[model samples]
Target: MLGGEEGIAVSGSAELRCFSAMASLLLRGIGTLVKSLAGLSCGQAPRCSSSSLPSGISSLQFSSTRCFSERPTVRDHPKRPLSAYIRYFMDQHVILHKQHPDLKRTEITRKIGQEWKALPDFVKEPYIVAANAERQKYKEEVKIYEDHLTPLEKKVQKAERQQKLAKRKSSRKRRELINMGKPKRARNAFNIFMSEHFQDASGMKAKEKFKSLFDDWGILESSRKQTYIQLAEDDKIRYENEMKSWEEQMIEIGREDLIRLKQRNKLKKLRPILKGPKVASKKKKTSVSRLKQSRKTAEPNEGRKARSRISRHEE
Candidate 1:
């Protein structure tokens, strides 16, 4: 009986040991499955510790929350219309931000139907037409102003040029006058003029006598003065004749062109009259036929009266 009881106790101990081992294995398998499910759900590597599981799960939840917060959300609020946004952009940003702000905003907005009635038809139509017409008109106006500016600039340039030219001419004249005042230059010029004009002995003697008389008359620089006077007179006469000839030639050319223009105008006027000559010829023929018919009717009564008188005398 003692041996059987001992056997039964040992069998119970072994069965208890086996059940403990299976229970430990089942717990380990469930823990691994839980870890694998947690890793799969959180998109993270499996952790060894139960303590680490809560923190990892919490981290994944926080990460998901952060990602959701960072994403842009479609709002449930009603949106403003596109036209309103466009109008706001144009008026507030485009118009106000310009360096030179347009004062014609009201007119433009009114034409675009953004603003209420502003200008009358007469005023508005012309402005709209002018704005929408060919840009070439604006270009042409700009060109005209540019052309005007060019002439103005040219006038200023021409004035400056004339002033420079006058200054140069004055400087040249002064230099010539200073050179003429020099004793050596005056002497050379006098010698050249005398050799040319007074080559004969009588003319030379007369010049010498004149010089002596001028010397007696207290004229110290007679020779130079006389040469300069003679040169001035000759230059004056030559310049006058040249100017007169040029003026006459210019006038003659102008008259010829004028006469040609008048003749051209007369011929243009006569052209229509000459083209209708056939109409005039037909009218003349009609008038001549009417005159011949009147003459035949006037002669028939006289011939009848003469016949009647001749018969009475024969009877």
Candidate 2:
């Protein structure tokens, strides 16, 4: 009788576990459904028409698929046409690869470049002409595409392009500065404290080390924390002074673009003064005015003397 009761208890626990698992799955499905519904209500798409749905798939399935798909991105314009060199390279690359199957991609490309250089102008002429034609066609297509885009869309696309260009330029400038052995920025009080205590938490995980250090710093006495803050302030002043001299050197070397934006603007405003013709000072102007007055008085006196000499000669 006890064995039978123990078996019944085990079965009951197993059934409860199964029911709990099913309930969790149901809850997950309902949560997903709620998210999909919320996204759909936000007008992610104007409306999912019945005509647009597949014959076999229900509206629900189609909507779910749309919800899971990636959001639409900014670019929809036609890709730019290939250059003449690229056109020739694409045509020859496959042939070269086949001829030298053992060669790596880079080696194949080098061979293609050699062959292209050896080829007569006549062979290259056709590719160049084709590229020019395609370029013209691309320009016309771009014009039509731009005309179709709304003003807001055009602005957004322009902003996105500008952002990409600025990011590329900034990264390039940073690389150039690093290569030039640019001075590092100053650290804050927390960072200074972290560096000092870094070895203490060496055994901890990367994230845990940071958390531990942060907690320690948080509970630190105000007087002790002030010492780190003072060091940070001194380091900051050193960094600013060093950066100022470094930026001046960069400007002298004609690499003004690597300097800070505020400094760059200041340089721009002062450019005319630095590279322009010199202006006469107020002292120089005054000396010139006095010389002119002396000349005027002397000229009148000389005229009077000349008139007296003419009268004496006439008598």
Candidate 3:
């Protein structure tokens, strides 16, 4: 009887474990379904519809499939490190697209994103591990390539890097020029100190200048920095309060687009636009009083020119 009872208890525990596993899976599936429904309800095409997505949003996925894009797009330049999420989605995108060749690229991407979100950590671990391995491999190869480069190659690489940086700067300058009305970020205590010494540091490269500033800041007594620090804190508070009020006003005014842009910090780059240098169509006129005085002074020269022209013709 004792042995039989122990056997029954073991079987019951096994059943409970099976039930729990099924329950967890069901919940995950339901959650995925709800998300799909929500995406469908929005009635907008998946954002990844285009071959090119916004920077830091999606990868430049080249498929043996359809083509779509919305904005002025450029090829990915100067590859940066990828995160685990990006790696997973990107790899999954190829497989899913190949399987459903007729589905829109954006549609596949939406499905992949949803699936990735639904996956338990354990299931994702293998992909993440593989991604990390690839990253390590890339780093090693890059180091080797750099080490093997000739002087010419090294110079070429440096020029390419500089060109990429210049492109980025030009893009930001354009954005700043266009969005001049965006609020300014408050300067901090360190910023004040830097402003005072900007002339001295102007000649240094960005990294060297920051290093020198750090050394100077380190030597300064805390008490002396306190006043500027307090001012910075106050300025930050003022900015935050103003930003909140501006956001409210934007909503009230029905400028949803501006609200989204502000949340994304896209508007922060805006400043008071400096108008282009005005070319005087005609030479700038002197003030009326100054013009009269100049006319009185120049009357003698005008008469001399007239006399010279008449005399030269006669001669």
Task: List the candidates' TM-scores in order.
Answer: 0.15, 0.43, 0.28
Error of 2 at 166 (Å): 2.4
**What global local distance difference test value does model 3 have?**
0.73
TM accuracy, model 1: 0.15
**Candidate 1: where is the Cα deviation over 4 Å?**
1-258, 261-269, 273-281
lDDT (Cα, tens digit) per residue for candidate 3, span 131-189:
78878877887777667676756776678779999999999866853474445679999
Scored against the true structure, residue 143 in model 2 reaches a CA lDDT of 92
Q: Model 1, 1-315: lDDT tens per residue?
A: 459889999999999999999999999999998775555533453334555557646444234333323433222322223333244336445544364366476655444453324436664554455444534465666566545554546566567769999999999866754453322222233444444545442424786855654443354377756765687566667655654454445345553222235554775688788786588788899999989988898789778888999999899
lDDT minimum window of 10 residues, candidate 1 = 73-82
Backbone clashes (count) for model 1: 0
How are the candidates ranked when ordered by lDDT, highest leading? Answer: 2, 3, 1
Clashing pairs in 2: none
Instruction: Pick the TM-score winner.
Output: 2
